[model samples]
Target chain A: MIKEFIRKRSIHVCLVCTGGCNGCDIEVAALLSQRYDLEQYGIYYHNNPRESDALLVTGTVAKQWQEKLVEFYNKVPEPKAVVAIGACALSGGIFQQESDKVGAPVSDVIPVDAEVPGCPPRPAEIAIAVLKYVPPTLASYRRKI
Target chain B: MSSVIWYLYEFARKTWIDRFLNAKTDPEIAEAPSRFRDFPEVQKDLCISCGACVFSCPSQGAIKLVRDEERENIFPVINKSSCIRCGFCVEVCPTEPKTLKTGENYLIMEEYRILPQEKVYIADEYLCIRCKKCLEACKIGAINFKDNVISIDQSKCVSCGDCINACPVKGAIKETYIINIDEQKEIINTLIKSLEGTINLEVERIRKLPDHDPDKIIKLEYPLADYLQKARNIIPNDEMIIKTVEKVTDRLKMNIITWDDEKCNQCRLCVNECPTGAIKYDEKIGKVERDPEKCLRCTICYQTCPFGVPGLYVARFLLKNNVILITLKPSQIPIRG
Candidate 1:
C-alpha cells in the first residue's frame, strides 16, 4: 500500500549531462520556473540517482562518460526510466565530426525509453516526455517484479 | 496607524489572495510564436512530384516520395522521428503558394525567394542526332557534353527556348509545362479524336468509289491543319502540340505508304526526285531497290511515279470494348504535291 501510494503521488528525476552544450539543460530547468512549474504534476528534480525514479539524460556521451554513464545508470533504482533529450543525446550532433575523440550517442552507452529530439527541445516537450513515457515504464517494471 | 491599517486591508482582500492560490501557468502547452517553424504540412494535389522536397531535406529518411492510398498520385511523406523541423523542405518547394508550409513567416529570408516557373525544358536524346546546336545557342552555357551525350544543366538553364529554336529536328528540344496536366491530356485526346474523324470521313467516300481498291495508291491533305487553332487555346505551345500529334499518329499507325516492286518501270524518275535517296536502280539485277530504313515516308516517290509504284493509305482507329481496331484504306483522290 505504501509503495502504491509513493508511485501514484510522486516521481523523482535525475538530470545527467554526458558531454554537450548546456542548451537542453536550460530548457529542462525552465520546467521548474513559474511559466511551466512541473512540480505541480507531482514530479521532483533531484540530482541523487539512488532515489530517483527516472533519468533525464542530455548531451552526446563523450569517451570519458561511457564508463561513468554505465555506473550512473546502475546506481538508479530498478523502476527507473531514461529519457534522452536533444539531438546530441539521440545522435551526436555537430560533435560527430570528432567521433573518435568525443561524440557518442547516449543510447550507445545505456538503454533509452523515450527521446525528445530537437537541437534543444522546448521545455513542454521535455515535461511531456517525462510524464508520458516514465509512468508506463515504471508500471511495467513493477509488473515484472 | 493609518499605514498599518491600509496594509492589513490589502492583505485581507479575497481577490488578491485567490490570485496566489491559483496555478501560475495554463494547464496546456503554451502556443509557439508565429515565426517558429515546426513540422511542415504537405498539400498533396499541388505537388508536381519534382522531388525538390526530397532533395533539399538534410536529414536522411526524414522525407520521401510515396504513392497515395489510391496509388494514383505520388507525394512526399515526412517521418516525424527523424525530422528535426528544420523547414528546408518548405523553403525549396518550387510550386506557387508552396506545396509544403510550416508557419506564417516560414520563408525566413527574402534572399531565398524561389521563382515559380510553369514551363521546364528538356532534351530528347533519340531525336538529338548528336548535334551540338543547343550547346552553342545557350547563352549561359547550360547545355554541355557529359559522358559523350549532351545533357541540360537544369540549374543554369533559364527556359529561354533559344535552344529549342536553334534545334533543326522537330521534337529534339521539348518545353514541358508543369501545370494543367489533366487539361493537357484532354487536349491530346481531343486532337487524336479530331484526326481520326477527318481521316474516317475520307475513308467513307473511298469505299463508294467504282475503282476503289483497298490497296490503291492515293493522296490526302494534312489531317490536323483545321484543328490546330482549336488545340492552341488550351495548349499555347504550337510546337508541343504538333509533337504530340506526330507521336500519336505514329503510335496509332494512322499513315502508311507501300512500295510495289513489280510496278517500277525503271524510268529512274523516283530515284532523281527522292530527297532522302531511299530508292536506287541496281545495274546488276536491272531492277530498282527501295530501303525502308532510309525512307522518310515523305511521299515524294508516290507523286513522281506515274505507274503508281508507291501506294499511300490512311488508317482510321475504332476503340471497341477496350480493344483498338485499325482499318486501312486508300485515299479517293491524289493529293497535289
Candidate 2:
C-alpha cells in the first residue's frame, strides 16, 4: 500500500549531464521554479538515483559518459524511464562528429524512453515529455482522472 | 493605538487579494520566444549527399550521408538517437534552398534507437575472373566463389571494404547496402540460390563424360602453374590477354604451392632464389609478404625451401574448403556412352 501511495503521489526525477553546453540543464531548472511550480504536477526532482523514479539526461554523450552514464543508469531503481533532453542527447547536437568526443550517443549506453529535441528545449516541453512518459497504470493516473 | 493601525496595514498586505494582484499574468516558458532553430531537416531534392553536412556536423555518426543505390546520390540521414540539434548541418549545406535547415516544427519525436546494421559488399561478376586470392586474404570466411562468381554472406560481412581494396579491377567490388541483419539474410539466401543453379549446370555437364585414361596424355583446358613458362613465352590471342596491346587479365588465382610457416626457419634463401621478386623478407620487421601480382608461379621458391615447407598444390586448391566439384572438363573426358 505504501509503495502504491509513493508511486501515485510522487515522481522523483534524477538529472544527468554528460557532454554539452548545459543549455538544456538551465531550461530543466526553470520547470520547478516558483512560477512553474512543478510540484503542482506531483513531479519531484532529486539528485539521488536510488530514490528517483525517472531519469532525465542532458548533453551530447562524450567518451567519458560511456562509463558514468551506465553507472548512474544502473543505480536508478526498477520500473524507471529514461528521458534524453536537448539536441546533444538526441544527435550529439553541435558536437556530433568531433574527434575529441566519444563515438556513442546517450541511448548507446542505457535504454531511453523519450527524447525532447531542441538546442535547449523549453520548460513546458520538458514538463510535457516527463508527464507523457509516466505510464497510465501509475497512481499519477488518479490525479489526471 | 498607532501600532494597531500598522498591524491592520500588514494584514491587508498579507491578504489573498494582494497576493493574487501581485502575480504576473503570463510568463515566457521557453528561452527564446521566436527562434526557429531546433531540429535539422534535410531537403531531399536539393541536397546532394556530398558529405559536406556530415563533415560539418560535430557529431561523428549523427549526420550521415547514406548512399541511395537507386538515385546514385548520397542522402543525408540525421541519426535522431544522438542528434544534438546544433544546426551545423544547415550552415554547411551548399545548396540554394540550404539542403539542411532547422525549424520549430522539424522535430522527430518518435521512439528511435541506433542498431548495428549489417551491410554487404558486392562484386561485379563480369569483371571478376573467379580469383580465389580474395578468399585467401580474407581473415573471416565471409566470401565464397561459385563457378568463378563471388558470393557473399552479408551477416558475416563487417563492411570493412577489404574486398574492394583486394580487387585487382577498379570498382569491381562495390561496398553497397546499409541494412539490418534480418533483411541482409533474405538477400543472401536469394543470391546463393541463383549461384547454386549455375554451379549445378557445370556439374551436370562434367558428370556426363567418361573417366580419363592414365595412358593418354591430357591437354589441360585450363592453364596450370606448369604452363607459367608458356604464358610468358607465347604471344597469346585470348580476349582476356592481348599481346599487341599487352592488356592482361591477371585476376586468375591458382595455389601453386603451400608453406607451413611453423616448420620453416626464417631463411632469406627462398627470398633470394625467387626470380620475379614475388617474395620479400623484411629483416627489420622479420615479416614476409608475397605479392601475387608479381608471382609468375615458377616453382623456384618451392624448390629452394630446404625445410620441406613447400607442398605442391593443384588448381583444385583454389576451391573453398578444397572441395573439387568438377576439375576435369568434358574435353578431358572421353564420350564412351
Question: What DockQ does each candidate score versus the true complex, computed on alpha carbons?
Answer: 0.07, 0.20
lDDT of 2 by residue, A1-145 (tens): 6877667567789988887898889888888798777887679999899999888999877787878888898898776788889877876666655355744357877888888876688788888788777543343333332
Kindly give the stretch of ten consecutive residues in candidate 1 chain A with the minimal lDDT sum: A94-103
Native-referenced DockQ of model 1: 0.07
Q: lDDT for each of the candidates?
A: 0.72, 0.60
Residue B320, model 1: lDDT of 35
Q: Per-residue lDDT of B133-184 in model 1, one digit per residue for the tens?
A: 8888889997988876777777676778899999998777777766677767
Interface Cα RMSD in Å, per prediction: 12.5, 11.1
The reply for model 2, stretches above 4 Å from the true place, is A1-9, A18-20, A59-75, A87-104, A136-145, B1-34, B48-51, B69-73, B103-337
